[model samples]
Target: MARAGAVNYLFGTRFYKMAYVEFGNPAAPAVVCVHGLTRNGRDFDALAEALSDRFHVICPDLPGRGKSDWLQDGLAYQPPTYVVALAHLLAQLNKPVSWVGTSLGGICGMMIAAAQNTPIKKLVLNDIGPYIPSASLQRIRDYMLEAPERFGSMADLTQHLREVHAPFGLLSDAEWAHLARFSARQVLDPTGSGKRIAMHYDPKIIDPMRAAVPLDVDMWPVWEMIHAPRLVIRGAESDLLLCETYERMLKEGAEGYVVADAGHAPALMDYESQARIKAFLLEG
Candidate 1:
């Protein structure tokens, strides 16, 4: 297990630092795992640890999430800005990488993999696809907008996460604990009396989502442009990635895996999920 490290870079004159964790030998094949919207790289801890024996796994905290710096402009949270920031991170790695992404992270990977001369060698989209239904988008947006800003204690916050992320599947108590531990930070109470626990990510990240709630997200052209062999993981009960879209992805030459008893997204923390991802990434 490698300790966390920070990568410093500039995005249009704004200096920012992105935090990341690494695992396995530096010389080993690189695998970059990105988290979903409102999630940080720590979400991949279990998966990264499991793959450390054979692959160098890098999980990065995108801007406004985890230990990374928050963008001054909320609008900068879009995919284009993420691509630029991730490009810098990839440049620092200086190696071809397999990408494992969840939701927002998957969208980023799709865009990068579709680009000319991209460094991505293979792509794994976890419970996300090229097309996002309007209903799903609205559901996510509503949840973010209504999320609590403060919690009286870690236990309270943990309970909140359990409810909000129940769609992540049947996580064990330990798994839920891990999510709670890394998903929040202490912040001064609004009353200016003491401190309270708050969600780890910047709330401003929802700004762009509020500004534009598109009828649906269509990225099929981007998906069509990608040449890298890919795998799509979907939660059997996911409202976000419909069965129709998953089937279409398979028809378009992508391998597919479905996790039962999960919704919206499957947490790749379990042994079976980790094994499936490792096998796909190791393929020739």
Candidate 2:
């Protein structure tokens, strides 16, 4: 296992604590792995550990998720705010960084890399593409809305993760347990009865999705603006990354990998998936 540490800092003027886990040597080249919506930084543990030998890995729990501070105003969860927060993180690194992002995290990567003079040197966008249909997006939002914020027991939380994230494919019992452990927090059960567990993220992290009228936005312009070397990962069964758009992205000169037996997103925890990402990032 690679050496690791937890670090936190105050970003913006809100004093919201931005937390992250760092792996490998600080002197090595950097790689930043950002997680999907409703998921936190720990999602990258396996991937980070795998890459730590060659790269310094940083996995940040975007505000309102995991160990990071939650925002009082849900509206602050928008992409612009997230982009600003990322800029702050990159500045702190004081060096160019490679990025690995899943789902919402991928979208965040696109916005940052599309900007003028971005610090992102290379990028891996997992299970997302330049565009997704409105209906597919609505389905994602609906599922999130249905998820219970608090669980009565570890069993309840693990069961819920299994159902919704079944697309992660066949993970070992230990893998599932790892997710359940890091994905939740023990909190006062509100009923004043002992304690219950709640999902680690702020429920309002989905506010932006809920508030918007669903529309199929054209993201090719965003895709085109990115000049860094890039790779796009698509789940074989993903509804969010349309086959047509993904193909177009590849034809547009970006490299792509399709993960088998997965949908919506690839967790990047499996060895094969990690190998694909590793090869892309390490290529000369």
Per-model clash counts, in order, read 1, 0
Task: Assess the local accuracy of residue 277 in candidate 1 as a C-alpha lDDT between 0 and 100.
Answer: 94
Return the top candidate by TM-score: 1
Model 2, runs deviating above 4 Å: 1-13, 192-195
Q: What C-alpha lDDT, on a 0 to 100 scale, does residue 225 get in candidate 1?
A: 99
Error of 1 at 110 (Å): 0.4
Per-residue lDDT of model 2, residues 133-204, tens digit only: 898788888988998867888988999999999887778888889899899898877677544888998888
Cα deviation of 141, candidate 2, in Å: 1.1
| Residue pairs with backbone atoms closer than 3 Å in model 2 (clashes) | none
- lDDT for predicted candidate 1 compared with the true structure: 0.91
Model 1 per-residue lDDT tens digits across residues 1-284: 76788788788887899898998987999999999998889899999999999999999999999999999999889898888889889999999999999999999999999999999999999999999999998988998999988888888888998888899999999999999988999888769644498999999999999998658999999999999999999999998898999999999999999998889889988889999999998888
